[model samples]
Target: MDHILVTGGAGFIGSNFVHFLVEHTDAKVTVVDKLTYAASRESIADLPADRVSLVVGDIADQPLMERLVAEHDAVVHYAAESHNDNSLADPSPFVHTNLIGTFSLLEAVRKAGTRLHHISTDEVYGDLELDDPERFTESTPYNPSSPYSSTKAGSDLLVRAWVRSFGVQATISNCSNNYGPWQHIEKFIPRQITNVIDGGRPKLYGAGQNVRDWIHADDHSSAVWTILTTGRIGETYLIGADGERNNLDVVRQILAHFGRPEDDFDHVTDRAGHDLRYAIDSTKLRTELGWSPRFGDFEKGLADTIEWYQAHEAWWRPHKDAVEASYAAKGQ
Candidate 1:
């Protein structure tokens, strides 16, 4: 049986990937997570205990990583400080986790001669001009603007280094924004859905003109799995559903789903250095791995996502207090 190791397996995308792996493949999966505030084990509450092994730990710990890499057939790295606003507030953690942590994992995999699949973000391409018709292809130049994306871009280079210098069989995937079930409430889709459901004002950053290509988390996970299993070594694949929408349009869609008006949002100042637009060209992954996103429709996907959050208050409500406290601590 193939034993696969997943870092940050308790996180939103990581947790979803874990479930997808266990259900779809016979691989003996080991999950190593630091279980930070954003990571809730409850996300995997339904996973069978026997098929999965959860290791509570950090990926930057070289010793633990070396051992895990030696034992597993492949490593799927998903751990990182992902919040852009939080990264702007403090960049050290992003550097530590996204850059240093990725370096540590690459070193471990190199020593053990193991295969690795690194998950990356399209934010590495920075912002696109409104009139720029080009999407972020695999060959796009790295022009990351935010501290968070800069660190991720740094990590992507390291993955390439491992493949070039050390001959580590590695594949990288850069994906667009993800939205679906089990997402943290702090994220836009869930936050807006929950707020609209409870008769609260949705917070908007600036004029909410920022555009993003959103993909369902399930589609993203499937793309990751496909790339890991079939992509060429030392290559990069862009994973996107090609569903682009401006921030305000997404917010309006969520509000409409809840039978609320579009003007229910409280517009606020834009975030510092916020990227105006991000879109990905996933044609490479689709053509090479025969992977196509099944949930590319924003309207239907947003509706399904909103409905999931509405019906799962037991899963989301407990985190409300903690989420509020985090914002309060951040003084947002």
Candidate 2:
């Protein structure tokens, strides 16, 4: 697509995707973001005006969505209320932003006939048994555990229905946990990194045995682009890098990075209904689309991420205090 509308483009993964577009493709992007506490204009402000334009707005606004969708060749939707803790505290925003917002975008695409690609998460497939040896594939059945994941599951279903019932040109992808530069300190990896940066200890939940499949955000961006152009309409792809690590292991690595005792972290109350493990088999994306992660080793990827937070203190410093305070309230 030559001109595209990206919802939530100022947020972490979306901003990373926008940067990836600027570097890898010729498409011009118009970003629609609510600019919530999770979003930062500075994340996208440095992009060339000719290539990227920011529009402060909500994704659920039908008139606005229609206008932007009509003006662009496609919509790469990344907007959602994504935090699990916030969703638990109040599911209202998650319902509005993730469910209703997706419905609005689907309607716009249905009317405008714009090519659409929806971003979703692997959490929709719920957690797997630690010893299951199975991984989530495109055909995995939905079993969302939290309000945030449930809303995302709902949005993915909406996209599928729009494509089948209305013939809207659309595709969907469910990606693994993403970590890299530009990530908000509220997120797991960045939270731990910034905690140590500020002379605080990293915190773990329960026994810290929950496992997550991790993929660098940049790799997630490239995989999305591959699916957007070459993927078939009405199909779904699972994106991952096969980087799986349990919570305790990841925390220990973070501590080692800071030259602190690996056992320095505190155990916080575990999340309500925490998923046990998540693994994604991305064979389809790799074998069909020839996609592979650039950051092959998880430790290497994570070390680079730690270095990023070190070098870009100005970018993350402003949000550090407030994010930690929020976590502190939750005893995380």
Candidate 3:
């Protein structure tokens, strides 16, 4: 596609994907974002103007959706209410953004005959028992545990229905936990990294046994571009780097990097309905698309991410207090 519309392009993964597109392809990108608290213009502030332009608007606005979809050759849907804790606190935004926002894009793309790729998270499959041995693949049954994931599940089903009923040319990818540059401080890795940078102890929740399959955002971006360009329409691809580490282990590693004791961090209350683990098996994506992740070593990737936050304190410092306050109120 020569012209692409990337929803949530001001946010973490979307902005990273936009940067990936600029370095790897010739396509022009149009970003549709509402600039939510989790989004930052600085995330994509320096991208070339001729190839990338930002349009401030809500994805749920159907009129805006149609106008933007018609102008682009493809749409990459990444906007969503994605935080589990926040979703548990108030599910209304998740329902509106993850469900209704996806519906709005599907309708617009269906009418415009635009190629579409939807970005989703593996949390929709819920948690696997820590020792379950089986990882989430494309055919995993939907067993979402939180409002955030359930709404994402609803959105994924909506895309499938549209493809079957209306022949909308679209593909979907559910990725593992992403950690890299420009990630908001609200996320786990960045939160811990920034906390250490500020001389604060890392916070661990309940015994910190929860596991996340980590993938660098750059890798996630490459895989999405692969699927958008080479993937079969109406098919779903799983994106992962096979990087799995538990929360306790991850926090200890972060503390070690900052010359703090492994047991220096505080243990806070875990959220209700927190899934125990998430792991993604990306064999299908690797076999079908010949895609491989470059960040094969989790520790190395984590170090690079920590370094990014350390060097860019200006990017995260302004938001740290508010984020910590929000978490404190939740008792987590």
Candidate 4:
């Protein structure tokens, strides 16, 4: 069986991708994660223990990366400091993990001469104007605004450099905001769902008008799998479901699903340097690779996501205290 190394496979998106790989392919999967406050091994509890190996470690550790890369057929890197709000509070970790950590992974992959697939966020394209009909494409120039996106942009450039200078077989996928089952409660969708279910109001930033193209994590995971198996080296693909919804609209939808009134949620001060909008065009991925999202409707997807969190409170409750503490410490 082909063996694949998945970095940050214990976190939200990373963990989902691991489950996808295990179920869809015959590949033996090894997951490397730092298991930070956000990551949980329970996310992957359904996988066969024997086939899935979980290594609790940092990605920047060169020796460990070299060993993992040397043995795996391919590497899917999903580990990074991903919260925009957290990045605004402190940028050092973003630089350390997103930029320097990615550099370390690149070096290891180069040394091993292994194929690498890197996960990136659409925030690297910076903000889209509210009236701008154009969607972000793969060829869109990088105009990262926040520290988090800027660091991610730096990492993307480094990956491109490695592919060009070192000729390392690598590809990158820039995807939009993802929401689905097992998402950490800190994100917008899950946080709202959990809070609403527990007789609390969902917090909205500013006037709640920031628009994001949200895709299901399962669809995003499947796209990652497609890129790993068949994508051309050095190519960057954009994966999105074209499901655009503003913060207020999203929360209201969740409220409606729960048979609660929209007025129940509270509006809070907007985040620092919040992107006004982000939308991605996945035409390249759709036309060239025949990859399109199976979950295309935000309403249905949102309802499904809410139901998942409702049914699995045990899985999410443990993280509630930490989530509150984090926000309280940030004074958000």
Candidate 5:
């Protein structure tokens, strides 16, 4: 594709993918974002202006999307109300953005005959048992737990329906937890890392035994690019890097890197309906697309993420206090 339109391109993963495209492809990228609290223009500010541009808008704006989709060779749908905590507090935005927004995008793509790639979360498969031998795959049943996940599940279904019924050229990828730079401080990893930077003990939810299969954003970006270019239409790919680490271990590793005691953190109430574990088996993606994650070492990737947060304090600092206060209000 010579030109691409990316929804939610100002947010964490989408912005990373935009950066990846600039470095890896000759395509010109136009990013449409609502500029929500979780997204930052600064994330994309330093990218080459000649190659990237931003349009302030919502994906649910049907007329706007129709115009934009008609211009780009392909669309990568990444816009969604993604925070589980926020979704729990209020599901209205989640439903509107994740479901209604996706429906709007699908319609636009169907009309424009544009190729599309839908981004989704592995949480749609719900949580696995802490000791389950099997991981989530393309065939895994949908068992979403939270409003955030349920709406994402709904959005994924919309893409499949559009593809089967309307012959819309689209592919879907449900990725595991992503950790890297430019992530909002409200997220788990960045929240803890920033707490440490502020000389405060990191807060843990419940026992901190919940496991998340982590993947670096760079790797996720590369895998998505691979799928968009080479994956089969109507195929669902699971993207992961075998980087499974439980919450306790993740916090300990963060404390270790900072020369603090591992058990210095406090335990907060766990999230309602929080899944116990999430693991992704990406064998099909690797075997079929010849794609693999570069950040195989979870510890090394964690360290690099810490370094990025430390170096870019100015980017995330303004929001740190408000995020912590919000969590404190909920006793989390």
Candidate 6:
């Protein structure tokens, strides 16, 4: 593709993908973002101006989507209200962005006959048992437990239906949890890393036994590009880096990296309907597309993430107090 349109390109994962595209490919990129609180322009501001441009808009705007979609070679749909806690508090924005926004994009792509790729989350398959040996695969049944994941599941189904019923040229990828630079402090890893940076004890939810399959955002970006360029249309790919650790283990590791006692943390109320575990079996992507993660070692990747947060305090400090206050009010 010569020119690609990316929605939510200012957010953590999307920005990472945009950077990957600029460095690894020759495509000119246009970013359409609503600039929600979760997104930051600074994340992508340093990219070459001629190669990358930003358009302040929402994916749910049909006319806007059509105009942008017609001008691009392909579309990477990444905009969504993705926080589980926020979805619990209010599901309306999730519905509008994840469900209706995807619908609007699908309609535009269907009409234009443009190639499209939809980014989704593995949480749409619900949580696997902590002891379950099986991991989520492309054929896993959708059993979403929260408003955030359910809407994402609905959006994934929408893409599938459009492909089958209207012949929209599209592919889908559901990635595991992502952690890297430029992620908002509201996320789990960045929250703990920033808390420790501020000389405060990291807070854990409940006993912190929940397990998540983690992948670096950079790896996720590479995997998405592989699927976007090489994979068959109407197929779904699962992207992961085989990083699995429980919340307790992750917090302790963060403390260890800071030279603090492993037990030096507070336990808070758990989130409502939190899933137990999420593991992805990405054999298809690896074997079919020959993709591999450069950050295969979680400890090294995490240490790099910690260092990034430490060095980028100015970018995160302005919003730290408000995020902490919101969490405190919710007792989590």
| Model 1 residue pairs with clashes | none
- How high is the CA lDDT of each candidate model? 0.89, 0.94, 0.95, 0.90, 0.97, 0.97
Clashes of each: 0, 0, 0, 0, 0, 0
Candidate 5 local lDDT, 46-129, one digit each (tens): 999999999999999999999999999999999999999999999999999999999999999999999999999999999899
Using lDDT as the measure, name the better of candidate 1 and candidate 5: 5
Global CA lDDT computed for model 2:
0.94
Tens-digit per-residue lDDT, 12-62, candidate 6? 999999999999999999999999999999999999999999999999999
Task: Give candidate 2's TM-score.
Answer: 0.98
lDDT string, candidate 4, 15-78, tens digits: 9898988888888899999999789988887899877999999998889889988999899999
Instruction: Name the lDDT of candidate 6.
Output: 0.97
RMSD of each: 1.5, 0.9, 0.7, 1.3, 0.5, 0.6
Model 1 regions more than 4 Å off: 322-332
How close to the true structure is residue 60 of candidate 6, measured as C-alpha lDDT?
95
**What is the lDDT for 244 in model 3?**
95
List, residue by residue over 1-332, the lDDT tens digit for candidate 3: 89999999999999999999999999999999999999999988899999999999999999999999999999999999898888988999999999999999999999999999999999999999999999999999999999999999999999999999999999999999999999889889999998898899888889999999999999999999999999999999999999999999999999988889999898999889989999999999999999999999999999999999989999889999999998998787
Tens digits of lDDT, candidate 1, 1-332:
39999999999999989999988998888999999888988888678887888899989999999998899999999999999888988999899999999999999999999989999999999989867898999889999998899999999999998899989999999999999988889887888788787788777878898999999998998999998888899999999998999989988887777778789888866778989999999898988789998886878888888888888999888877677566556443
**Candidate 4 global Cα RMSD:** 1.3
Q: Which ten residues in a row have the lowest lDDT in candidate 3?
A: 80-89
Clashing pairs in 6: none
Report the C-alpha lDDT of model 2 over 58-133, residue by residue, as the tens digit: 9999999999999999889999999999899999999999999999999999999999999999999999999998
By TM-score, the better pick of 4 and 6 is: 6
